[model samples]
Every structure is written in C-alpha cells, then in structure tokens.
Target: MQKTRPILAWETLLDIARTDAPAPLRERVEHALRRAIDDGHLVPGSALPPSRTLAENLGVSRWVITEAYGQLVAEGVLDARAGSVTRVAAPTLSERMPPPHPPSDHPAPTATPVDARFDLRPGLPDLRATPRARWGSAVKAALSSIADRDLAAAHPGGYAPARQAVSDYLGRSRHVATTADRVVITHGASDGMSILARELRRQGHRAILVEDPSWPRLRDIAQTHGLRTIPIPVDDDGIDVEALAAASVRTGARVALLTPAHQFPVGAALSPARREQVIAWAHAVDGLIIEDDYDAEFRYDRRPIAALQRLAPDRVALIGSLSKSVSPALGLGWMVLPHGLNPEHSPAMPSLIDQAALAHFLVRGDLERHLRAARSRFRRRRAALLDALRAELPDASISGIAAGMHLLLELPAGADAAELARRGRDHGLALTPLRRYEDVSRRPEALVLGYGNLDDTLVSAATAALATLLRARSETPVASVRSERTLTG
Candidate 1:
C-alpha cells in the first residue's frame, strides 16, 4: 500500500530564498534549503514541492531549483529516489557524532558574565551612538559614484580616494605631514603595528624599545616577530627618552614604540623637551619611532598635541585608527609611512566598499559633524563618571581624564586591586586592574576605569558599588587580609 507523504512548508523555504545571499542563485537556493532542514523547519520524510512549482513560486528559472535539489541530493542532505518526491534525509554519520566534552579538571570557557551591570573595560567607544543613517547614506553615495573598474581589484596600499581622504583629514586634524602616496591603509592600528614589526625584523633590527607599562599587545606584537623588547619607563612627560636612549645604547635596539599624543593606560603628553630629546635620540641612533596616535581625537583640556610625526616626519611612522573616535568594529586605520620606508609586504587592507564609503563620508564632512556631536556626548559621560567617583571615593587618585575614554584610578595603599577586580565580577560590575597591563613585580594598586561604554545613567550606582567593595576591604583585619593575599597569590 502506498503511504501519504508529509508536505514541506514552502513559505519558510520561500522566505529564505528571497533573503540576500553572497552566492549564485542556484547556490543560494541550495544553502537556504539546507538551512531550513538544519533548523528543523523541514524535517525528515517531508516532501519538497516539484522543481516547476518551487521555481514559479520563487520567481526563478526551473533550472535553478533543479540544480539546487540535485546538489543537495548529491550531498546526502536530500533524498531523491528516481520516482520519489525529494525529502530531507536522515542525519549523516558525520552529523551524528556526540559533542566533545572538556577534561574533568578544566571547565568550558564562558562569555561575559550574564549578571554584568556595568562594563568598564577600556578601548571601546559608545557603540550606541553609531551614525547608522548617515553611514548608510554614505555607502549608497559611494556605490553610486564608484567606477566599475575600481571594484575589480584593490590597491595593496589602499583605495586611492580613501587614502587621499585620510591624508587630508590627518593634515587638518592631527597636523601629520604626509601625502596620499605615503599613506598605507590598514585593517586597524594593530594590523599596522604588526606590519611595521615584521618589516623591522626583516630590516635586521633585533631589539625594539617599548613603554614599560604600555599596552601589552604592542609588546606582544614585537616579541612575536622575533624582536627583543626593552622596557622604557614612562613618567608624567610621556616615555622617558633618556632611559630609552640608555636602553638603546645597552641593547643596540634602534626602534621604539610610543603613544606620544596621549599615552595609553596612563595619560601623559610627550613634553616639548622630551619630544625634542626623542627626535634627537632617533637621529643620533638612526633609529625609527612608531607613534600610536590611538585616542588623539577627543582631548577636552585644550587643543590636542600635534602628531609627533609632524615634528620629524622622516624619523616617525605614525599609526592612527577610527577605533577610538569612531567605532572599532569598522576596522579602519591608516599608517603615514616615513619617506623611503615603505614595507616590502603590504599590510591587509579593509573592505574596498568600506574604504569607498569612508571617502564619501569624509568628503561630505559627515565625519567632522559626527565628531562634534560625539565630543559633546562623551564629554558629558566622562564628567558624570568622574563626579560619581569623586563623591564615592574622595581619597582615590584619579588621573588620565584630560582626554580619551578611560581614566587611571589609584586606590589607597594596601588595597588589593586584583582582588577588587575579581569581586567586581561577582557584584555585576566589570573592572580591570592595572596589573593586567604591567609586569608582575610592578604593583600600582590601581584600576583602569573605562567610561566610554558605561551609560551615563549607571555612573552613580556603579561607583557606589565599587566604593562599597573598597570600604569592605579596608574593614578587614590586617592579618586576615595578608593571609588571604598569601593564599591567593
């Protein structure tokens, strides 16, 4: 006796097919059907509509439907016995394997705590403020204006118009001296640093000088490329050029990495004297300086210091990115290469479409207008966080607030910053201890509080929670605190 077949719901399949896909029409149909089956919208023993019927429904050629069905059948995702209606096949042997479990001693990794109330992790912008409508308009303008030939292949350095836009923006804003010809677009500052590190290694440089308590990632990048990193202490006047020079002499290291505009983790502008000293040191050693202009766009105290590259363009390689001023997710950055120092290998570039869109955005003056509004918003958020912190913990030393999204908070002596950070996680407040960025022996008993992502409304509550924890720590008996530290350390 023949049995009735279960009819598949064509609406689900039709919706999936109509959605945008990056592949050919036939491949899109195949992927859509597979997704429907995997998602349980189409179960095993369900019969698909005939190719002619589905093609008519989808407004595609019958050949497309047939090809999709044929491919799925070949892959064992669909069953099409000569005269039988096509149906989802049983789970393949490869798909039947059980999920692997972690070792009993090691637990599976977890994401950000579900209970997190405030995120204070630094190096993030206010994602809520992204200019979606303006960006969409820029993208549309870019698509309409771009030549067809420009899309066929991208220049390794960057899309020409995008590079020009960046060059002009830098000149006007940061006072960086460079032309589009010398600009190399990159995925972001990290990618630009990696490229420079590799090129430095290739150029027979064995050692590189880095700030002692700098962003750990920069040192890691140099070390990864086989360059020994000599730690140079950074004081209130930015990187210690005298110490850096001494280190260079001792180690024969000729390359240095600096965040001259506003130092990371610790905000200190390179003083006029130190700037001269650094440039002189570079000239004396015939060395190179890699300047990371990470957050030079949002200075509140006064006009931002001019790019160090502008002082001696031939001696410095300046790297800047949109991560701080704009959203990091854009993954767009530029490197103003020193004259006669182009890398043999080009660093990875961002999407050509993104490059075109940015060019349009810049040319239309949308970026400048957006930044004016962002500065006002971030300024208010920063002030709120600072006011809350001051009210909660008057004795705690807070600095590095002159610019950038984060500030350095130095707790009173004997406070365990690491322990506070750990406890913060439990209390639904995410915190980062200064120790995370420094060497193990260097303990500043400080925390880097990022106010960028923290909502203005949560400032008072989050600060109060942090103060309560600190007060609790202060109340513990000295002996008990030492014992706890000994056990944890």
Candidate 2:
C-alpha cells in the first residue's frame, strides 16, 4: 500500500520564537523529542542540538534558541555551557514511563547530529521563520469547523479540506492541476516515498533510477524497502535524461525520482524541453517519475518556475512541503499522484493503498488549514530571508540567490567547508557545509549558507563572521600561494 508522503520538519524549540512559531509548536516538537528520547527513538544521552545549531536548523536566529536551550539546561532537561556540543540531559521521565515507540523494523535511523551547521544537509529547509499567528488562526478555524462525527475514522488518503487546499495550492502556485481526491497526505515526503516504495515493490517493481549526487536519503528509503536504486548523473540541465534512459534500460529500473526545479544542492532547473523528454521516457517505458520539489518557493532572481507536475500530472508524482517555504517543524507536506493512480483504479490509473493510521488522523484532523496558513506565512518569510542574504553576504558572490532559504558561494578550491562551519559555531554562528551535499571527494569547494530563519541582524553577523573566516584563510600560507598546477588546470 502506498502511503501519501507528508513531510517532516525537525526543529527543537518554538517556545521562545520571537516571530516564527508559537508555544504549541515548540511544545509539540520538544515533546516529540522528549518522547523519542524516553521511547528510545533518540538514544539516552544522545548528543542534543547545540541551541545555536537548533536555531539554524529551524530558521530562528540563534540567540533566542540559545536562551531557550539555557532554560532546558536550567530545567535539567539538557546540558548547557557545553561549548560546541549539545548533549541531551539524562532521561528524567522515569516517574511514569511512557509507551515505547514501536520498534522500527528498519533499524536504520540515520544518526544526524541535531547541531550540524553549515548543514548543506539535503532534504531540509530553514523553517524557523513561519508566521505563527496566521497558522494558529487557521488551526483554530479548522478545528472549530470540524463536525464531531468528522473526527471518526476516514480515508487514509487525507482529509478533504486540506487535500483540497493542497490541490489548490499546487495548481495555483505550481501550475499543476489536480483534484483533492488525488492528494495523499502522509507524514512528509519520506512517508510518501515509503508508500510508493511499498506499493511498487508489492507489484514486483525492483529498481529505482536516481541522480548520482541526488538525495542520499531517498535511495536509503528506497533500498530500505528492497528497491534497487540506479544512479543517473545530472548536469546543468537537470538529470541526464539520455543517461537515465540508458541506466533504466541497463538496470530495468522503471521508476525515477527528480528534483527538476532547483535540483537539490547544485540548484539546476530542468529545462522545459528536457522535462518534456522525461515525460516521454516515462510514458514510453510505463515507468513512474517522482518529482521531488525540494526547494521551489524561494527563487530570488526571477519568478518561481512552474512544477514538472504541470506538464504531465498523470505520470509525475509531485512531492511538495512547507519545510522550505515555511517551517519543517510543522510536519506538513503532500504528495499528488496522477489521476492514473488507484484505488481510483483503472488500467490507465495506478492504484495506491493508504495507510491505516494516516486515514484515522485525517478523519479527525485540522492539518489542512494549518498547511494553508503555513504556506502563506512561509512565502512572506522567504522574501525577508532573501533580502537578508543579499545584504549580509555582499562579498561572497552568492548565486542561485534567486530562491530558497539558502544560497551558495563559489569559494576557492581546497577551502575546508567543515572547518569554516566549526569556526562559525565557535563564535555563536551556524552554517551548512557545501561538502555535505556535493560529492565532497570530487565536487568543487563551496558553502550552502541559509538566510531563512535568521533576522537581518544575525544574518549580517553570520555573513560578517564568514567574511572574516574567508579573509583569514586568504592570509594563510596555503591559500595565498595555490599550487600553480591547481590554478592552471
């Protein structure tokens, strides 16, 4: 059964959010973390997020979150004053042991440090800046409007109002037309992929064709469910379609996932013509295309491009979420399947089964309204973040500044991205390393700095620190005299 993949937004605190989130958000995320800890989802005494890194990951300026972490420290929930490391306090929840999270059969929970800065970690967006009041109002409205009976068990596909909102949001915002009935709301894009993986596997689907430097997690999720992933290299125009076709034929992998618009870290947009060719390939091979729209909302240079889902809704599974546009902590994202998909089944349609828990949640949920509010707030915050990036990184020569919460800097070769991140963290600053996303062993040196969560002041500080770091590096022996051979080539 295919579960509609909803997206997950992981932020530590919303309690002290000066602007982005509210107490409930903070409480919920923190509560989840606490439960995960006590329940073993997060190991006991696992390295907790350095408040500063938590701030960066959530799109909040670091100081506010730093203070919040101090509170947790004071409350004995976390260890404070642990420079550069945020360690979870020993579990104090023994009073009434909470229910254990069912052990995941997939024992692989990727061990990601909550405090990783200069993250450049793929599949995430700066989400600490979404407008709280707006979302609160939406949630209130959705809840008030719900019928007592509506809260009873319903379709696992998703709730109608939220599904309609998503369908509308995609159609209007992304130029992809679809009815709410076709939308499946899972926990996040990850959940959607799992469902897709499961369904395809059940029907004998064996392999997935993917971009070589594509999101590692997608392949992880795919392989977790027994699908062989084929690597297809990407160039400036997005995935090498010809290469993908060749790989598909060579490997007999019929399903392929793509980030055509703002293709992951390199920020390549698939040309319109190439998108058409991809559609043709899918149709010709009876294959499926998973269009992962990782970051389409914050293009700075020009208008946002329409989604590939628009060109061929029947063949493309459009994956979108508010993580980048707003806050990942909200855990709101959606999957739009082609009208060809099932249980709306037909030969032309691909039938998908829904998960039971997801079905139960929607029957009694207010998620749809929250998504609407989140999208609206995120759009506004994205603009603000962009302005901050431009003002702060004046000397860095930022490109792909067109959209998204983050931008890239073309740094000198051999620049140590991890070192730069470390130095930033040492001084109350946080950032993502370009090496985290690219083929570090081979890709050019760069940095993926985020502007979404921080206010102008912090953004400026981060940039200023970055400038100093780069300057110091330039003055160093290694940078001042690059091997003549390194430059000649």
TM-score of 1: 0.79
The list of candidate 2 runs beyond 4 A from truth reads: 1-128, 343-398, 439-441, 474-489
Predicted model with the maximum lDDT? 1
Task: Write candidate 2's Cα lDDT for 1-489 as tens digits.
Answer: 112321222342333344344465445445545555566545434566655667677766666566555666677766545333555665556734765764666755533344544333334544454456555655555666666775664645765666766776677667887888888776567767777887778878899988756667777899998998877776667788999888888888889989887766655678777889999999999988998888676554455788888887888898776556555665666788986565321121111121222222234333345444544544565455445544643334444434455556656655787777666666555656666654322455666655545443444455556667766766642243222110000
> Every model's Cα RMSD, please?
9.0, 16.8
Using all chains and alpha carbons, the TM-scores for the candidates as numbered come to 0.79, 0.64
| Window of ten residues with lowest summed lDDT in model 2 | 480-489
Q: Per-residue alpha-carbon lDDT of model 1 for 176-258, expressed as tens digits?
A: 99999999888888888889999998899999999868889878988999999888887677888888998899999999999
Angstrom error at residue 138, model 1: 1.7
lDDT of model 2, residue 485: 14
How far in Å is the alpha carbon of 406 misplaced in model 1? 0.6
